[model samples]
Target: MKHQHCRKAGNVLMIVGLVVMVSSIIFSVLNQLPSIQMPALLAQGAILGIFIGALLWLAGARVSGRERIEDRYFWHRHYDERCRRTPHH
Candidate 1:
């Protein structure tokens, strides 16, 4: 799949997960009854959203045509050089 598609799917999954989690919270609150399952459901939704979102975002970043300076070891070397050149108090 294309990077754009992956990114879009990730966004959708994240949004759906957030909605599910929020709804679960509201359901539990409005019911005024503490249920063990509610906590489990909320945790699942949040974890799923964050995990999938991170995966997709990473995929998009990896496949994108642009080069990332952060991804290069040379960048780190240059970073140290630049830091050395800067005045420190």
Candidate 2:
């Protein structure tokens, strides 16, 4: 039960991270007033937001195990008895 809860939380965290990253990029691009100090600050903040979002995504992936890579060629599950035996021509 706890693992399920953790997984849900982790997934939510990942979504939040994505939102942060996207918003940062959008705002940074939209703020074209290079002469203003606030725009400069926003540009800097965009960088920080990207970094923070990446960290959050990593943490969430670790907790959720949803990002883990898998080898498609291998499966350890037991096969049917007929599959275990040699095929007869």
lDDT of each: 0.56, 0.73
Residue-wise C-alpha lDDT for candidate 2, range 4-43, written one tens digit per residue? 9889988988998998888887777666656544556778
> Model 2 clash pairs?
none
State every prediction's TM-score relative to the real structure. Answer: 0.39, 0.65
Best by TM-score: 2
User: What's the lDDT of the predicted structure labeled candidate 1?
Assistant: 0.56
Evaluate model 2: give its TM-score.
0.65
- Tell me how many clashing residue pairs each candidate has: 0, 0
Question: How far does residue 40 in candidate 1 sit from its true spot (Å)?
Answer: 15
Candidate 1 lDDT at 86 equals: 62
lDDT of 1 by residue, 1-89 (tens): 88787557656655565565566565545445554345666656655655555554554454553237355656555555664556445
Q: Which stretches of candidate 1 lie over 4 Å from their true place?
A: 33-89
